[model samples]
Target: MGLDWAYFRRPYEELHDRHDAAERQEYLVGRQPTAAAHLAELAPLRKREPIPASGYTGDDERLWQIMKLYALSRVSDYLIELFCPAGDPPPGFGVTGGRAVMEGSTTHRLELGGWQINATPGWIGSRRLELDELAAYTGFFTDIGLTPFEHAETFSPFHHEIFAVMQDPSATRVILEEVLWPGFWFGDLLFSRAGVRVRAPRHLIDAAVATTSTLYFTFSREPRPTSDLSHNWGSNSQWRTSFHRFYSDEDGLHLNWDGQVDIGEDPPQQPADQSDDPNPLDQRRELLLHRCFVRSALPRDEDDRFPYDDRLSLTTAEWPLRPESIVRVPWTR
Candidate 1:
């Protein structure tokens, strides 16, 4: 939700604010995205998709690259539509800015065309100044059978994206600190992990490290080169991709959307679907969870591995994680 859904810096008036409108009515009034042209553009993306087959492997990095590419393109659509019409974000474009809670406001730092534009704009009386109105435009997702999920009672790396964290030295486990932004679900497929602030032990989740702003949804939460989808496909099809639906309960982790793809058993460190490559899963689904949502909630090699330490190894049952792939834990659902 952080970088993937970057702040729409303009005033709320710039967005036809739909908070007061009904969900159905909002869809009726929002941008009428053309599907024929957009789908044609996204059809080629599947040729590079590596999920279910590369769920917990090295190729997962390539998957993250694709996800960031999708997010950047979507966020760029809002930026170009609202701010700089003449602007075109290059291939390596990334943003750095978020809520300044101390000031009770939000700001953005956009580097483009050899200049840095730091914008601290007013939210036009909206409660969430950081969120662009487009974040709420879920018509494409819902209309196609995908569900948008945001609220969670507890904290789980699988269900919530680590936007911000609190260090409690005496804390035994993660506590639900705050909800930053909503995530999405497609029946059992986790489209996007909900953005939330989590309270955890400093030993398990470092405060300074986790709070340090970079790009939250980018490849492995670190800098990496990715493509822009808007330059090719419209925003419509990118909203429909694929993700592994994993669920957590009092028992433990349940991979593949409570057994959607059925990776034989749980703890998908190795893919169990011995089916065909490229699809093994999506071919059997009615809706495709956007690859952007596949940003991977687990910790990966040299990527956000600091939040997890030997303490986590001792408590693997607490949160089944790997950092860059898809999975669930026994906490937030």
Candidate 2:
């Protein structure tokens, strides 16, 4: 089934309006900070004013405001990651693998053994045969603050947790000041290895999501004790290195960033067998992490770092946004 674009259109507008009004009220209440103001500036789609969703009209500027917010919300993950503290790979990850075998067979079938068995024409005997097998493998590591969920950028699985913590306005501000700016700056440094930098208004970028909209993904099963894939071990180590280059978020392993990243030369893709296929992994998570960053950052290098967001925002675009469907089946000789 396809998205009910017509139905979706209305809700999208409504959510955008509500979010904008709330933020505006906060701004007027002297609750707004420079970071928020910076974020708010980028709400509208650059060249076009919001066209009313079909069947709505009049003085509902709120609709326009919200529509803009909805658009921005789409990239919230990137903005949040950019702003939140990251770096220092998360604990407990790397090289877990295993295999499982089926113990039962539901049906019995007789196969003719070459010419000898055919001539005999008798059951080899109702014996169990081994065939079906599944291989299980897992790798673990903290991805820092990378969104485990990837659907809408502004949406997060931890939104409730963060909001609960931000019940106090002061706390929210701290997040903006300490977490947001530095986190964002560091994210730029990490990805810029491939010469990509995305700098945009954070609020405007955040407003683009529907509140009901959320990122959903199935996490891989926890790593098991089996064979080891150590090279693939280490969680977001490269990302951690980038973060440390800027600032240390806490102590020990964590890191943060204080400013914009310098984009240098493009880095070659790591060997596929070395690290998981970033594209496929990005897809299973709906590319929420990758996409939000791309949308928020301005790509300055020849390589724009694969636009993972394009993979996540599948609802509006053409069908088959889910990458796993593209997995190939081996041909039999």
**Cα lDDT of all candidates, in order?**
0.35, 0.21
TM-score of 2: 0.17
Candidate 1 lDDT, 1-333, residue by residue in tens: 112221212222233453433442454335334222232233323221223522334344434433433442343334222321122223322111132112233467633223544554321111112233334434444443345776676665556655445566788876777765566553333445665666667556554334332222232322221222222444444432222234333333343331223322232222244432232222111012211211112122222211100011111223323333333232212
Error of 1 at 266 (Å): 14
What is the model-wide C-alpha lDDT for candidate 2? 0.21
**Each candidate: RMSD:** 14.9, 25.2
The residue pairs in collision within model 1 are 241-289, 241-290, 242-289, 245-257, 298-322, 298-323, 298-324, 299-322, 299-323
Worst 10 residues of 1 by lDDT: 305-314
47-107 per-residue lDDT for model 2 (tens digits): 2221232322434443344333332232332223222222221232210111112234445
Best by TM-score: 1
Clash totals in order: 9, 34
**What residue runs in model 2 are displaced by over 4 Å at the alpha carbon?**
1-67, 70-79, 93-333
